[model samples]
Target: MEDLAIARACAEFADDKKAENIRILDLRGLSPVIDYFVLCSATSAPQLRAVRDNIEDEMKEKHGQRPLYKDGNYESQWLIIDYGNVMVHVLTPEKREYYALEELWGDAPEVALKSDEPAPEPKPRAKKVAAKKPAAKKAATKRATKKKAD
Candidate 1:
């Protein structure tokens, strides 16, 4: 199946379980390493396995596809499911934050899932508050005034 199709399939599969923080990053330009990266996190090990199985089933049953490689199943910490064009990473919250895959591949163009149920909007950007003039600035102004007085 095409990379986009596989990505869509994986996203749909993940959505089925209401996976948290579902993301599909297009990594074609970032690196020749992979075409796309589909990532999500599960609350528990069983949930992780379920998400992985759902993805596999969606690909195979809906698109007649299977993963070319899979790892971390025994450990159940992070599952990397590779389908050549698309790579799926099902991780735990701790593992996901620790690995910071999104930051690792920050250059990739992200593809947000458009569904009737809107995804949680990306976290709000931190506002840069203007710093107040320090006491040193006030003291400097006072010194300049005193010099002018003298």
Candidate 2:
């Protein structure tokens, strides 16, 4: 699979495990070492393990891709799955906040996920009108009536 596809697949697998704040960074031109980075946050150790394992298993089974190197553990609150061209990071909320990979790789553009359905259109905002004082109201009403008569 391509680097972006692999990164997206890893993100999908992580989402399958209810991973939070999932993001895919496009480092194609920015980084010479890696093409993409898939980052996600898990609430607890069990969830961390689930997100990591699911990504690994699904990638291997569906895409026939396996990580070239893997590091960290659930207890450490962070895990790295290195796929040579793509790197997947599964981290706990605290560790993710501490590391701040997004800020560190600030130059890398984020990849938008593909959605099956179209995005909902934004609702129009209501226009605000200033309250008219009693004198202004009378004058405005008289002008409107005068215009109608004319």
Candidate 3:
């Protein structure tokens, strides 16, 4: 499977485990690095391992896929499952926050994992009116004063 497809599949599997902060970053343009980065966090060390295992199991069951390499299992603070074109990071909350993989790879476009729950509609951003020139401000002030007097 392609990296993007693997990312989506792994994300779905992670979601089943209630993994938090599921994100897929497209790293193709960033460097000769992997094609995609799938980052997520679990509550505890055991949960981290569960997610790591889930990725392996789900990938194999769904797509006959397995990681080319896997590491960081001894400590369980972080677990990385490298699936050729894509890499999955399962981390504890502390490790996730401390490392900030999203920020570290800020340049890459993120692909959000879909869930059964509908996503909240994005709140409208406040539009930035161009800053008023000094003269414009003075005129507005004069107008306001005139209106008050009237």
Candidate 4:
């Protein structure tokens, strides 16, 4: 599969597994080591494995591509799946927090996380209205009530 396509597929698979804070960094211009870095956080070991398995399965089934190397297991807090140009990092919250790949790759442009459905239309903004204090509101209401009573 193409490098960008591989990275996007990884993100889709990770998102499908409900991985938190999924980020795809475009490292093509900045890093010589890899073209893209797909980072995601799983809540638990089981989730981490599920996300990893999903990525592997989807990539293989759809694109006929598999990770050239897989590192770490379900026990480990972090799992790295190296697919040549694109590397996927499936990490636990702790491991993700400690590593902070987003901060580390501050220079690299992040790929937008997209879902299967079409983007929702932006909602129209309501006109801003000044809010009256409770005391003023109450006083106004009392005056209105007195006028009606009179």
Models sorted by lDDT, best on top:
2, 4, 1, 3
- Winner on lDDT between 3 and 4 is 4
Pairs of colliding residues, candidate 1:
none
Question: Measured by TM-score, how close is model 3 to the native structure?
Answer: 0.73
What lDDT tens digits, residue by residue, belong to model 4 across residues 27-144?
Answer: 7656666878999999998899899999999999989998899999888799999999899999998988898888898877777666443322323434557976889889999999
lDDT of 2 by residue, 29-127 (tens): 566678789999999999988999999999999999989999997789999999998999999999999999999989777787554432233224335
TM for every model, in the order presented, reads 0.73, 0.75, 0.73, 0.73
> After superposing candidate 2, which stretches have Cα over 4 Å from the reference?
115-150
Candidate 4 residue pairs in clash (backbone atoms < 3 Å): none
Candidate achieving the largest lDDT: 2
Tens digit of per-residue lDDT, candidate 1, span 3-118: 76677679889879877899988776556558778999898888888998888988898789989998887365899999997899988889999999999988666876653332
Candidate 1 residues lying further than 4 Å off, grouped into runs, are: 74-76, 115-150
